[model samples]
Target: MGTTYLTARLNGGEARYKLPGGHPLTGRSTPDLELTDDGRLADHLHGGRALLLDLTDDPELRALAAGYADRVDTLTADCPSRPELAAVLVRPDGFTAWAADVGAQALTSTAGLAEAPEKWFGVPAGAVTPG
Candidate 1:
Protein backbone atom coordinates (compact mmCIF):
# COMPACT_ATOMS: atom_id res chain seq x y z
CA MET A 1 0.00 0.00 0.00
CA GLY A 2 2.65 2.49 1.06
CA THR A 3 5.14 1.42 -1.56
CA THR A 4 2.56 1.94 -4.27
CA TYR A 5 2.03 5.49 -3.16
CA LEU A 6 5.76 6.19 -3.26
CA THR A 7 6.33 4.65 -6.66
CA ALA A 8 3.74 6.97 -8.13
CA ARG A 9 5.16 10.08 -6.50
CA LEU A 10 8.83 9.31 -7.05
CA ASN A 11 8.92 7.33 -10.25
CA GLY A 12 6.14 9.28 -11.99
CA GLY A 13 5.19 6.05 -13.70
CA GLU A 14 2.51 3.41 -13.45
CA ALA A 15 2.53 1.88 -9.96
CA ARG A 16 3.40 -1.75 -9.41
CA TYR A 17 1.29 -3.49 -6.83
CA LYS A 18 1.69 -6.98 -5.37
CA LEU A 19 -0.26 -8.83 -2.74
CA PRO A 20 1.47 -11.37 -0.54
CA GLY A 21 -0.39 -14.62 -0.22
CA GLY A 22 0.51 -17.15 2.49
CA HIS A 23 0.05 -17.99 6.12
CA PRO A 24 -0.65 -14.96 8.25
CA LEU A 25 2.36 -15.74 10.40
CA THR A 26 4.82 -15.56 7.54
CA GLY A 27 5.78 -12.05 8.52
CA ARG A 28 5.06 -12.41 12.23
CA SER A 29 8.10 -14.51 13.10
CA THR A 30 10.55 -12.64 10.91
CA PRO A 31 12.98 -10.06 12.26
CA ASP A 32 11.82 -6.48 12.01
CA LEU A 33 14.83 -4.99 10.24
CA GLU A 34 15.03 -7.88 7.82
CA LEU A 35 12.75 -8.23 4.86
CA THR A 36 9.87 -10.66 5.10
CA ASP A 37 8.56 -12.95 2.38
CA ASP A 38 7.40 -9.76 0.75
CA GLY A 39 10.69 -8.69 -0.78
CA ARG A 40 9.36 -5.65 -2.61
CA LEU A 41 9.18 -3.60 0.59
CA ALA A 42 12.82 -4.11 1.44
CA ASP A 43 13.87 -3.65 -2.14
CA HIS A 44 12.16 -0.28 -2.32
CA LEU A 45 13.85 0.94 0.83
CA HIS A 46 17.27 -0.19 -0.27
CA GLY A 47 16.79 1.22 -3.74
CA GLY A 48 15.72 4.56 -2.29
CA ARG A 49 18.74 4.84 -0.01
CA ALA A 50 16.47 5.04 3.02
CA LEU A 51 17.41 3.77 6.46
CA LEU A 52 15.63 0.91 8.17
CA LEU A 53 15.40 1.03 11.96
CA ASP A 54 14.36 -1.54 14.55
CA LEU A 55 12.89 0.32 17.50
CA THR A 56 12.44 -2.59 19.87
CA ASP A 57 16.17 -2.70 20.52
CA ASP A 58 16.42 1.09 20.73
CA PRO A 59 13.50 2.92 22.31
CA GLU A 60 15.06 6.32 21.71
CA LEU A 61 15.28 5.75 17.99
CA ARG A 62 11.75 4.43 17.91
CA ALA A 63 10.38 7.44 19.75
CA LEU A 64 12.22 9.78 17.44
CA ALA A 65 10.97 8.00 14.35
CA ALA A 66 7.46 7.92 15.74
CA GLY A 67 7.52 11.65 16.31
CA TYR A 68 8.73 12.45 12.86
CA ALA A 69 6.45 9.95 11.23
CA ASP A 70 3.53 11.60 13.01
CA ARG A 71 4.40 14.97 11.51
CA VAL A 72 4.21 13.50 8.03
CA ASP A 73 1.16 11.31 8.05
CA THR A 74 2.33 9.77 4.82
CA LEU A 75 5.49 8.50 6.47
CA THR A 76 4.26 6.56 9.50
CA ALA A 77 2.34 3.37 10.16
CA ASP A 78 1.77 0.75 12.80
CA CYS A 79 3.54 -2.35 11.65
CA PRO A 80 1.48 -5.04 13.32
CA SER A 81 3.81 -7.71 12.00
CA ARG A 82 7.05 -5.99 12.92
CA PRO A 83 6.40 -3.71 15.83
CA GLU A 84 10.06 -3.54 16.71
CA LEU A 85 11.24 -2.04 13.47
CA ALA A 86 10.72 1.70 13.35
CA ALA A 87 12.01 2.66 9.91
CA VAL A 88 13.30 6.20 9.58
CA LEU A 89 15.36 8.74 7.60
CA VAL A 90 17.47 11.52 9.05
CA ARG A 91 17.53 14.89 7.35
CA PRO A 92 20.78 16.79 6.99
CA ASP A 93 19.77 18.86 10.01
CA GLY A 94 19.73 15.74 12.15
CA PHE A 95 15.93 15.63 12.20
CA THR A 96 13.77 12.77 11.09
CA ALA A 97 13.10 13.81 7.51
CA TRP A 98 10.79 10.98 6.54
CA ALA A 99 9.62 7.65 7.95
CA ALA A 100 7.93 4.74 6.20
CA ASP A 101 8.58 1.22 5.06
CA VAL A 102 8.29 0.48 1.32
CA GLY A 103 6.08 3.49 0.67
CA ALA A 104 8.65 6.23 1.11
CA GLN A 105 10.99 5.35 -1.73
CA ALA A 106 9.69 8.16 -3.88
CA LEU A 107 10.17 10.89 -1.29
CA THR A 108 13.59 9.61 -0.36
CA SER A 109 14.90 8.98 -3.85
CA THR A 110 13.15 11.60 -5.95
CA ALA A 111 15.38 14.19 -7.62
CA GLY A 112 15.43 17.56 -5.86
CA LEU A 113 13.67 16.05 -2.87
CA ALA A 114 16.48 17.28 -0.68
CA GLU A 115 16.66 20.80 -2.04
CA ALA A 116 15.03 22.13 1.09
CA PRO A 117 18.09 21.14 3.05
CA GLU A 118 20.87 23.43 1.96
CA LYS A 119 23.43 21.25 3.69
CA TRP A 120 22.60 18.13 1.71
CA PHE A 121 19.82 16.40 -0.28
CA GLY A 122 20.09 16.97 -4.03
CA VAL A 123 23.06 15.92 -6.13
CA PRO A 124 25.95 14.66 -4.06
CA ALA A 125 28.74 17.15 -4.27
CA GLY A 126 32.07 16.73 -2.58
CA ALA A 127 32.17 17.84 1.04
CA VAL A 128 32.19 21.57 1.65
CA THR A 129 34.25 22.84 4.58
CA PRO A 130 33.80 26.00 6.60
CA GLY A 131 35.32 29.14 5.09
Candidate 2:
Protein backbone atom coordinates (compact mmCIF):
# COMPACT_ATOMS: atom_id res chain seq x y z
CA MET A 1 0.00 0.00 0.00
CA GLY A 2 1.10 3.60 -0.54
CA THR A 3 2.16 5.66 2.48
CA THR A 4 -0.85 6.70 4.56
CA TYR A 5 0.69 9.71 6.20
CA LEU A 6 -0.92 12.97 5.20
CA THR A 7 0.29 16.00 7.10
CA ALA A 8 -1.70 19.07 8.10
CA ARG A 9 -1.44 21.53 10.95
CA LEU A 10 -3.70 21.14 14.02
CA ASN A 11 -4.13 22.85 17.36
CA GLY A 12 -1.45 25.41 16.48
CA GLY A 13 1.15 22.68 16.00
CA GLU A 14 2.73 21.56 12.76
CA ALA A 15 1.22 18.29 11.52
CA ARG A 16 2.95 15.08 12.51
CA TYR A 17 2.09 11.52 11.48
CA LYS A 18 2.92 8.23 13.08
CA LEU A 19 2.04 5.17 11.02
CA PRO A 20 -1.67 4.34 11.29
CA GLY A 21 -2.34 1.88 14.12
CA GLY A 22 1.21 2.32 15.44
CA HIS A 23 0.82 4.81 18.28
CA PRO A 24 -1.48 5.35 21.21
CA LEU A 25 -3.16 8.27 19.48
CA THR A 26 -2.67 7.08 15.90
CA GLY A 27 -3.59 3.42 15.61
CA ARG A 28 -6.85 1.50 15.55
CA SER A 29 -7.11 -0.55 18.68
CA THR A 30 -9.06 -3.63 19.75
CA PRO A 31 -11.84 -1.50 21.17
CA ASP A 32 -11.98 0.40 17.93
CA LEU A 33 -12.47 -2.86 16.08
CA GLU A 34 -14.99 -4.19 18.57
CA LEU A 35 -17.26 -1.19 18.36
CA THR A 36 -20.04 -1.35 15.82
CA ASP A 37 -23.80 -1.79 15.69
CA ASP A 38 -23.20 -5.54 15.54
CA GLY A 39 -19.94 -5.47 17.49
CA ARG A 40 -17.71 -5.59 14.42
CA LEU A 41 -15.66 -2.70 13.13
CA ALA A 42 -14.16 -2.38 9.69
CA ASP A 43 -10.43 -2.15 9.30
CA HIS A 44 -10.88 1.01 7.31
CA LEU A 45 -13.90 3.23 7.00
CA HIS A 46 -15.95 1.93 4.05
CA GLY A 47 -17.09 5.47 3.46
CA GLY A 48 -15.00 8.62 3.66
CA ARG A 49 -16.36 9.82 6.99
CA ALA A 50 -13.96 10.26 9.91
CA LEU A 51 -14.35 8.47 13.27
CA LEU A 52 -14.11 10.05 16.69
CA LEU A 53 -13.03 7.79 19.53
CA ASP A 54 -14.43 9.37 22.68
CA LEU A 55 -12.55 7.57 25.42
CA THR A 56 -14.03 9.69 28.16
CA ASP A 57 -17.55 9.51 29.62
CA ASP A 58 -17.57 13.05 30.94
CA PRO A 59 -20.73 14.79 29.74
CA GLU A 60 -18.75 17.78 28.58
CA LEU A 61 -16.34 15.53 26.74
CA ARG A 62 -19.20 13.55 25.19
CA ALA A 63 -20.73 16.82 24.09
CA LEU A 64 -17.42 17.75 22.59
CA ALA A 65 -17.48 14.51 20.63
CA ALA A 66 -21.09 15.06 19.60
CA GLY A 67 -20.35 18.49 18.17
CA TYR A 68 -18.11 16.83 15.63
CA ALA A 69 -20.38 13.85 15.00
CA ASP A 70 -21.77 15.42 11.87
CA ARG A 71 -18.47 14.52 10.24
CA VAL A 72 -17.41 11.62 12.42
CA ASP A 73 -18.51 8.33 13.95
CA THR A 74 -18.24 9.28 17.61
CA LEU A 75 -17.75 6.11 19.64
CA THR A 76 -17.07 5.91 23.35
CA ALA A 77 -14.65 3.21 24.53
CA ASP A 78 -11.62 2.43 26.68
CA CYS A 79 -8.40 3.05 24.79
CA PRO A 80 -4.89 2.00 25.62
CA SER A 81 -2.44 4.64 26.83
CA ARG A 82 -4.85 7.48 26.22
CA PRO A 83 -5.64 8.47 29.77
CA GLU A 84 -4.45 11.97 28.97
CA LEU A 85 -6.77 12.43 26.02
CA ALA A 86 -10.45 13.21 26.15
CA ALA A 87 -10.82 11.91 22.62
CA VAL A 88 -9.09 11.08 19.33
CA LEU A 89 -10.30 11.61 15.78
CA VAL A 90 -9.65 8.64 13.51
CA ARG A 91 -9.83 9.15 9.78
CA PRO A 92 -11.75 6.87 7.43
CA ASP A 93 -8.53 5.19 6.48
CA GLY A 94 -8.03 4.40 10.15
CA PHE A 95 -5.48 7.11 10.84
CA THR A 96 -5.67 9.66 13.62
CA ALA A 97 -7.08 13.02 12.57
CA TRP A 98 -6.52 14.69 15.94
CA ALA A 99 -6.26 14.04 19.68
CA ALA A 100 -7.75 16.02 22.58
CA ASP A 101 -6.10 16.16 25.97
CA VAL A 102 -7.92 15.80 29.30
CA GLY A 103 -8.67 19.37 30.27
CA ALA A 104 -11.98 21.17 30.42
CA GLN A 105 -10.58 24.06 28.47
CA ALA A 106 -9.07 21.90 25.78
CA LEU A 107 -12.13 19.65 25.49
CA THR A 108 -14.51 22.58 25.32
CA SER A 109 -12.71 24.71 22.77
CA THR A 110 -13.57 24.69 19.10
CA ALA A 111 -9.87 25.07 18.48
CA GLY A 112 -9.06 21.65 19.94
CA LEU A 113 -11.85 19.76 18.20
CA ALA A 114 -12.77 21.67 15.06
CA GLU A 115 -9.53 22.17 13.14
CA ALA A 116 -8.95 18.51 12.37
CA PRO A 117 -12.17 18.09 10.38
CA GLU A 118 -11.18 20.76 7.86
CA LYS A 119 -7.66 19.49 7.66
CA TRP A 120 -8.61 15.82 7.36
CA PHE A 121 -12.14 15.66 5.98
CA GLY A 122 -11.88 18.57 3.54
CA VAL A 123 -15.51 19.50 4.08
CA PRO A 124 -17.27 22.12 6.15
CA ALA A 125 -19.98 21.25 8.65
CA GLY A 126 -23.49 20.46 7.29
CA ALA A 127 -22.00 19.42 3.95
CA VAL A 128 -23.49 16.18 2.63
CA THR A 129 -20.28 14.92 1.08
CA PRO A 130 -16.63 14.77 2.14
CA GLY A 131 -13.67 15.09 -0.15
CA RMSD per model (angstroms): 14.5, 9.4
For 50-86, candidate 1 gives per-residue lDDT tens digits of: 3334322344444433423422212233445665334
Off by over 4 Å in 2: 1-48, 61-70, 122-131
* TM-score computed on alpha carbons, candidate 2: 0.50
lDDT of each: 0.35, 0.55
All candidates' TM-scores?
0.22, 0.50
Q: After superposition, how far is residue 35 of candidate 2 from its true place, in Å?
A: 7.6
Off by over 4 Å in 1: 1-34, 37-40, 43-52, 71-131
Global Cα lDDT for candidate 2: 0.55
Per-residue alpha-carbon lDDT of model 2 for 1-131, expressed as tens digits?
12232222323223446442223555332234443333434543566777766666656655545655667776676544446666667777555656666664555455345556656656554548635
User: Which number leads on lDDT?
Assistant: 2
- Candidate 2 backbone clash number: 1
